[model samples]
Structure formats: C-alpha cells, structure tokens
Target: MRTNLDFSPLFRSSIGFDRMLNALEAASRTEMVDNWPSYDIVKTTEDDYRIAMDVAGFSPDELTITQEQNMLLVSGQKTNGEEVHYLHRGIASRSFQRRFELADHVKIVGAGLANGLLTVDLKREIPEEMKPREIEIKTNIALPKAESRQIEAEKAA
Candidate 1:
C-alpha cells in the first residue's frame, strides 16, 4: 500500500503576505509549543507586559525559565516527596511546560514566585525615532509673545 500527501491546495493559494509565511514557519515549530499549568498574559503599559501562571506545588529548583530567540519557555517538575501513606489525595503536583511568543525588542525584565503565582515581567524599549514626539510647526508670524499677549487680552482681562 502507498500513502499519498497532497500540496495542490497550498500551491494554488496566493502568496504575498509575510505574516502568512511566518505562521507557516511557526507551525513547523510545534515542538516549541507548551500547554500546561494555565497562564495569563497581561498588558501593563503600552510597551510593558506581564505573564502570570498558576505554578502551585512547584519549587524554584524544579522550575526553569529561559529565553530562546524571541520565545519565553517555563518548565517545571514535581519532585518526589518522602514515602508516606495517604488515605485520600486531591491536589495535583505534576510536571508542566509553558511557552510564550514574544514580540520584537521584547526582553524579560525579571521573574518572581509569590504564594502560588509565578509572574514574569517584560519590557520593550522603543527607539527615540519610533517613540511618539511632538513636531514643532514653523510659522511666518515672528512677533514677540509679550506684545501679542497684551493685544489679545485687551477686552478679556
């Protein structure tokens, strides 16, 4: 028996968008994707961001955070505790993995674990040219402000 794969549809589609190409490239990196421990991405500021995850029952030693290219990965493992007898068990302390796709120029500021929440801070430093700046408009009226102010307030004050 012979199995066949088709690429006719993909080849027939229009190819002009850079974003679409990037998406295809990212799809090839499925191994980098992580879906564990539940997480939330919050936008703190226009150029600042934070990631909070519920990493309960995981110690700092078992957790590892690293940045690969423009990706943030967080992995943790549950260490084996001392032998004991349990009549009933309900809590989950299994290992987990989480991944975050970061934007250009986005850098991790720091990370902290408090209570049962693990928070990671990220900041993007925009260039001076890219930042919003007020442009000065030049005009032909070169009169002094002192005289112009008195004339404009003749009837007001």
Candidate 2:
C-alpha cells in the first residue's frame, strides 16, 4: 500500500523551501523498482562524503558522471561485443542510470574505479559570505556632564 503525503501545511508556513519540499514529495511518490548496481553513501567527515557503486562489468569509458546545479547523474552503458551463450547467466551488464540530489554548495571532488567499484568523492564548501559570522555589538557612549547641565538650564529658562 502506498500513502500520499500532503505538504500543503508546510507550504503555507515555510518560505524559500519549495524545492526541498517538492523533492520530498516527488521521492514519496516515486517507486524504485530497479535496484541494480548496488551503491553505498558514506559521510567521511563533517563536510566530506563518498558514494561507492558496484559496477562489476562496466569499464571507465562505459560510465559517465555529470553534475548540473543541485543534481548528480551517473550512467553506464555496456558496449556491444561478441555474443556468448551461457547456460546459467548471473552477472548483469545492462545499462542503468542513477541520480542524486546534492545540497547547495556540495561539489564533486574526484572519482576513481578500482576492483569493480566506482567511488565518487564530494565535499561541501560553504562560501565565505554564507558561513556563520560573529557580529560586534556597539554600546552607546555616555553624554558629557556639561551637555546635560546645559539641557537642564535651558529647560529651567
């Protein structure tokens, strides 16, 4: 059974969070039927992350990684080779595409393929202006006694 979530209340109260809410709603509605080429996401540090995927039969040239705005796309396409018949085929070498939603400043650092595993590194680099900063509070200086006396004399007059 699939349940639909209503984000109308959040929409009414939240500001500048439309994209996040929309993503959540879309994720809830999507049915992930294909889970081939298993992958894992791990956070190495406070701002570093890694995505490792098991692409056993895919070569470096057969895989593609692209980043656009807040979206990361990874795809693989096997090249046509000599056809070989197998009595019991088990390994999967089909084409597949995977997508990941990245945060505001998350960037792809590097990627490597080894031992049939594709590893992608990511780091979150917050801009200087966007980083948290401390503000210095200024206190008002006290008025001079002569100025206070002049104001009192003028009021008396």
Candidate 3:
C-alpha cells in the first residue's frame, strides 16, 4: 500500500526543510525494501550516536561508507572467491546498499567492523554560532546624552 502526502501547509511555516521531508517520504514509500542485513541505531551520549549493522561473511575492505550532505550511504560488494562444495549455504553474501538520512549538525565520526557487525559512530556537533546563547538585555536606567544634558539643565534651574 502507498499513500501520497501533501506538505503545502508545512511549507508556509518552514524553510529549507524540503530535502528532509522528501527523504522521509521516500523512506516511507520504500518501506517494503529487503532486509538483507539487520542494523541498530543507538544514542551513546547527548550528541553521540552509533549505528551497528550485521555484515556476516563480509570484510571491512569490501564495504564502502560515503556521506553526502545529510545522507549516509553504506554499501558492500562481495568478490568472487574460491568455490567450496557445500550441500547447503545459510549465510548470505550478497551486495547491498543502504541509505540513511541524517539530521542537521549530525556527522559521521567513525566506523568499525567486528565479529560480523559493522558499527558506525555519529556525532552532532552544533557550531558555536548555532548553539543556544543567552542574550543580555539592558534596562532603561540610562538615558541618551541629549536627555542627560536636558535633565542636568533642569536640575540646575
């Protein structure tokens, strides 16, 4: 089943969020994608995150991780190896490509492959200018130079 979404109302109040909404809509449409390798996403800290994927029988060199803007791409290609006569094969060694949409300020920190699991770390580093800041507000206790001079003259009179 597929459903179309209208974001015209949201566009009136939001700017520069079209890409993100498009990513979400695309993901929703492809909900029936093949679940080749399982994965997990965990928040390690306030600004840190980790993505772990199962890549059994796949080596680190055979996997490729690429980041473009707010999109993260992870793909694996298995190379032809020595043939082994086996009556049954259970483990899957097929090529796959996964796309992950990331939020603003989120970036890939690092990645590692261990025990058939591929872990990718991410961190959200908000720049100093973008971080929340407290603004200092001044009261109306002080007046302009002209007003101060006029008040002084009135006092002298």
Q: Which stretches of candidate 3 lie over 4 Å from their true place?
A: 8-14, 137-141, 145-157
Q: List the global CA lDDT of all models.
A: 0.79, 0.94, 0.89
Measured with C-alpha atoms, the lDDT of residue 115 in candidate 2 is 95
TM-score of each: 0.64, 0.83, 0.80
lDDT of 1 at 132: 95
User: Please, what's the RMSD in Å of model 3?
Assistant: 5.5
> Model 3 residue 87 lDDT?
92
- Per-residue lDDT of 1-157 in model 1, one digit per residue for the tens? 4334343466468576555556565555435544568789999999899999988878888899999977898988877889879798655677877777777679999999999889999999777888799989888977776644444445664
Clashing pairs in 3: none
Q: Highest lDDT among the candidates is held by which one?
A: 2
- Tell me the spans in candidate 2 whose CA falls farther than 4 Å from its real position: 136-157
In angstroms, give how far residue 42 of model 1 lies from its true place: 1.1
lDDT, candidate 3, 1-157, per-residue tens: 6677776687678889988767766766645667878999999999999999999999988999999998999999999899999799999998999888899899999999999999999999999999899999988877656633434344553
**Candidate with the larger lDDT of 1 and 3:** 3
Candidate 3 least-lDDT 10 residues: 148-157
